[model samples]
Target: MAEALPRRPPPPTIYRSAAGEAAIRALYDKALAALPYEHAERLVETSFGTAHVLVCGPADAPPGEPDQDAELDPAKHEYGKWALEVLRGLGLVPPANADGGKGTAPPPLHMGTSFGAAVVLDLANVAPEAIRGAALVAPGGLSAVNPWAFALRLMLPAVLYRLLPCSLTAWLSLVSVCDEPAAEELEVVLMGWKHIVRYPPLPGGPSGVFLPDQLSRLTAPTIIICGEHDIWPCKATAAAAAALPDCKTIIIPGAKHFPAKQHLIQAADWILDWFAVKGLVPAATK
Candidate 1:
């Protein structure tokens, strides 16, 4: 995350006209327009009435398919595949892929991919009563991101980011955890390359699909966010939260899948306030 980044090769902002999509866009714009220049922050934090632990997970709770990455991209075939396999070796499946791929390879044991994060995921589904509040925005689980979007994430290496395309520069700068393109095997890639000439995964082969049930079990005060331009599962994610005991769905306008950057301030305000509402932090915290 430290190297110089590639400047985004500006592409004309293409407009799409779906109601939900429009809402997301308008919301992102409106949210960013509201950020005061002074307090804008890259990091978002909030404490709920409950012990606020911001745990990140894939959209669904199951491990993504042996290969499925909730976020996928066309140019990222190599990186995605690599990450998927490595993560699979560890066992932190992206919550969408329950059973590995279609074949009978023995499912991997628990993912030991250890990143020093304090948020204990097992607690996410079951918050203690004292932990009266919770807020979620695109956790760590897997979901199929647009192919182009996924490629944008892979354009740079971990420490060397300047390689990112200029137009996608901001996206590369945005916060994301890149995983592999799930479900596809070498045969699929070889076939596409041979026949289609340039067939990067349109939608991947057989990785795990996002399931609503993974979220249907949550029982905490929750806030969910979606980005306007976020094409995949934006509405579906919000809908999944509907069954939660307490939940609110928010759409960030104008922003795409990664609304955290566009609406970071607004998001911080909402998350903190949700915590404040439940009296988790001192009234003076805000």
Candidate 2:
């Protein structure tokens, strides 16, 4: 008889203790409570694992959109595909190539920030027909980044957590300018640093980088938002916008790598306006 295959180990948990998990949950709940719109939390089973999704907005909304955040790994495209499948299963989106390749359902929109944006682009390259539009914020992998510099900058927070693992250090590490939303984000970061047993290595060696040909394959209308002061991906974003057949680039003034809450709101307005222009959503009333 053939030997049995070894089972893969489970992924690492983010919290060190039950209390830490509870604290993070409390913060999440507080944020959700503050949202003007009602939302529901769902746990959907995917081929890879269970995905926790937060569903907001009206139930009869025209089309479904997925938003990704803070994921850097190139392998994230697999997860994105699974997420799209889940939406199809829920009847929130139409299946790939539905209705004999002439489906009437509106295609889904995708939005992502930083490394998540890279994953969105990967998905667009692989499955252009399924997506109608994309909004990318400070997307990485468009051009070469110094792996050492990027890794060091990303690891600074974790190093601070190791040396003085407190809320203050976490806040100091994240806050360029302090605000209410920044404080809330700090709570989550502090909990994560305090509890995570292992931190994944930052992507390197062309893991997420896309070539010119790959960028040109993204046929869907895309909006790339880059912060003026964002050192990493500004030039790459410009290059990507130039390459994509239907893409627009927006540079936010007085913004850095991670945009502030106000800047995020501005980005959202732009996305909504673009969607309206594309006939994906209704135009805002004056």
Among these predictions, the greatest TM-score belongs to 2
Candidate 2 residue-wise lDDT, 108-223, digit = tens: 77787876676566666656666788888887756555455455544675687779877766766565322233666787677677665554422222355677787787788888
Worst 10 residues of 2 by lDDT: 63-72
lDDT (tens digit, per residue) of candidate 1 on 224-247: 655655634556555655656666
Tell me model 2's lDDT, rounded to 2 decimals.
0.65
TM-score: model 1 vs. ground truth: 0.37
TM-score of each: 0.37, 0.77
Best by lDDT: 2
